[model samples]
Target chain A: MSTSQGLRAWLLTEEPTSRRQARMAAWYKGWLTLRSNTLAMLGLMVLVVLLLAAIFAPLLATHDPFAQDLGQRLLAPGEGGHLLGTDSLGRDIYSRLLYGARISIYIVALVVMVAPVVGLIVGTVAGYAGGWIDVLLMRMTDIFLAFPRLILALAFVAALGAGIENAVLAISLTAWPPYARIARAETLTIRNSDYIHAIRLQGAGPLRIVTQHIWPLCISSLVIRVTLDMAGIILTAAGLGFLGLGAQPPSPEWGAMISEGRKYILDSWWVATIPGIAIFSISLAFNLLGDGLRDVLDPKEGQS
Target chain B: MSAIDIRNLTVWFGHGADRADAVRDVSFEVADGESFGLVGESGSGKSTILRAIAGLVPTWSGQMTVAGETLGPKRSKSFYRKVQMVFQDPYASLHPRHTVDRVLSEAMQLHGVRDIDTRIGRLLDDVGLGPGFRFRYPHQLSGGQRQRVAIARALACDPAIVLLDEPTSALDVSVQAEILNLLTDLRQEHKLTYVMVSHDLGVVGHLCERIGVMQEGRFVEVLSVEAMRRQQAEAPYTRHLLESSINSIR
Candidate 1:
């Protein structure tokens, strides 16, 4: 929050007693910041609305997204029961967009949850382990990083089946290297600190020191990086879906919805434009949310 | 059994010609409850000897006996609690993230000592700090106050022996005497054994009953506090040290 210049160090200590209270204070501070940031608040509100729309899709959609009326095909806006109009087969565009949120939300959930954990483990271990282990692990990370991200994801998805899970797995494969590098650098900084040595002398084993001392200190950076990476992950997932390598058709995935509407772009613009807008808003929301989180998570960076 | 006994202890660092012996073939014994001071100039290996005993230095070959028990490469938790260390820089020594309360209580908790709050409060009082300083972080305290907290931490385990690594060197000169005085009072009150390292001969003279003048990884001579204070050091190196030490004072 604006009231504090920086975080106190003791909140990061291994003590279990003060931790919950301090973390609650930190979150309260972060919420205060979130409230002050108008754009982030707007982004949060948009995200919440999208989520609610997705959950209530069954109730909100007047017609099934898949059920098509060939007779009323390509109906214009404000015509019949179709409020925003219909697609080539006369399917409701609004219904499809709401359902598309589920696919986007699922892919993002999977990628963000899995990628950073993979990276944090690999990086911190390699950094803390040092010597040949560090050399071997980091070089492996470098090898993965040498390839272009999208190309690597495409290759992995191609090798696996062309499905949403495959795309998520592929995205994860390309996503973890940078996180590993971040985690490794953070671990190196923490490993040499005098506090680590002090803990070691206090009869704390390596595991104790890493989990209690190193992980907590490194988590703030990892969280900021991971949150910021969400937009890119979503874009990549959409790219896969557009290429027919993600969620199959009839599932109402945003990218697939766009791809389906591509041929009718000249005659009916709303079909593709509506889904495209959905993707754009979600990505913007993630970026805005990320910027807000970075402020609260690392207040020192915000100040300087 | 002596508080500490080392037989031909040798600690080295690096490899080949780059290899340097920090404490080489050095043998010494500190009696129970005796305040032993290792007085030497910088890079003279006094601190290295302290580190070797503290188990901070990984590679060392020798027989080390503490309170009748033989020590191995890895000292046990019980052994760690039995012998604690106070590092040179008070600012550098304590964990900045941990409050004085946690710093004092963590070791006791590890050793399964109950009554943590009372012990912590008493430890604060023992170091000339108050209960108000308990939750304060290291940076929140002044140099002297932090050093007091460090001393309190070292004494928290009811340790039989304490290692002092230039404990007052990092403090302001005005605060140095107060810390030294606190340390002296704590040692006497607890009847604790001390193996303190200091480059300043006078500081050691005031704190230690017997002082060892270490040079080039070995003790040139060990003299009584009375002999050192009376300027009756025997070895030529000891006399040379005394002269420079006195000259610095002048």
Candidate 2:
């Protein structure tokens, strides 16, 4: 109780003791605002559950997700120790859903890591350097943007050979164009700000100006944008998986599971419908979380 | 030698059909430890002169020298070490995400200054802000306080020439006097050369020893503060400017 009180005091302190403390307090304040938002909290809770389920999948699954008992095929939900039921192959739906969370998260993590960073560097450099450089980078971004996201991802995946890694790489290559556009837009505005000019007066070169001065301002907007893009990223990955271009058979990937269950979907709806529901719920969770993050992180709202 | 020298400085934007001259062949010199002011109406290019000196704008032809070093198309790191600029808007001048400590420390680090921890403490104190304010973000401070932090950041490099781009124009009238007084004290203490730009005649007069009146991108007159005070301006435009300034005050 005393420790909790001490932590609360520290978070609320106007005078922070160190740089770390100050940064933490600023972040804690953002968390406090986020906590007050109910829908955001709900979205955060769902994501937390998804993360936990992925981590504890082996321990939590009552049966091996890959084990196929042909006799038990097409069992309804809650029949014979299968809580969510069995797929057409008799693999437990409940256990597969738990493990599938890892694939979805992994793809999301990898795509998120690759796309926005590439976008940020490209956008900031193009925006700050301006002139021929701006024309060159932005034109390149425009070319990438001209392609439909899924079609581009599909084309890349087809060439790279079918697998989850190829799917992630494809999505990352397609996803970065929007981020670059956003970062470039944000950078164009930020580069003209007085703080940037002041930094330049300190003899900071274009690289330092873009990375240190301009990037910090651009990040808040980019973070909000990246969060909002998560749902689209998830859907794109799922589309690849459903098309049999991602996560090979028996991997229990949610989309692939849905693809396999499609044959039995008409007779026993739970097979495909269950994994479809899982995908829908996770996508909805991401949308909600992104909206909540937008409220907290949007610089235009003066929260920053 | 003068601390700052500019000969036949011509600054413009765009080219051909879209050309616009901001400062045209303007020549001026500021002696060591002198406080020079550029006063003009908006769009008269008072701030452009400072921007040219600080190397913020590239489309310029000029012979510019500061602290015994000549300026070229590109500014050297050592040039930045000897010169720094405080922007007009305090709110806009500070990095919103960075704390006051970070802003000050970054400026020092750029100049390769050591013993930062102690220097930051002293800088904050010098700007009349206490040590407790160091960790606070710009949003956490008032406009006046943010300006103080900006001033402190400029001082962090210990530049011999500190350019003031209408430092107090965005501040409250109540806070403006305090900031002006602080600028005066710091100038005397550091023996720094200043080239300040402002539209407010009273403000320019308060800080600068000599004031240049600009009209239509050219200097109409350069007069001492005493001459301005005595209304002894030789140029017809200078007299009109003084009259408008007095009328505005009245």
Q: Pick the candidate with the highest DockQ.
A: 2
- What value does DockQ give for candidate 2? 0.71
Cα deviation in Å at residue A51, candidate 1? Answer: 4.8
Candidate 1 on A158-179: residue-level lDDT in tens?
Answer: 6876789888887887889999
Window of ten residues with lowest summed lDDT in model 2 chain B: B91-100
DockQ for the candidates, in order: 0.28, 0.71
Q: Ten consecutive residues with minimal summed lDDT in candidate 1 chain A?
A: A8-17
Q: Over the stretch B1-250, how does candidate 1's per-residue lDDT look in tens digits? A: 6889989999999879999998888888999999999998899999999888888888889899986678898889888778888888777767645667677787677667889988887888888877667776675678899888878777777888998999999988889999888888888899899999999987898899999889999889988999987899889999999999899889
Measured on C-alpha atoms, candidate 2 has an lDDT of 0.90
Task: Tell how far residue B159 is off in model 2, in angstroms.
Answer: 1.2
Clashing pairs for model 1 are none
List candidate 2 segments past 4 Å from native.
Answer: none
How good is model 2 by TM-score? 0.98
Give Cα distance to truth, residue B113, candidate 1, Å.
Answer: 2.4
lDDT of each: 0.81, 0.90
Cα displacement (angstroms), candidate 2, residue B197, comes to: 0.8
Give the top-scoring candidate (TM-score): 2
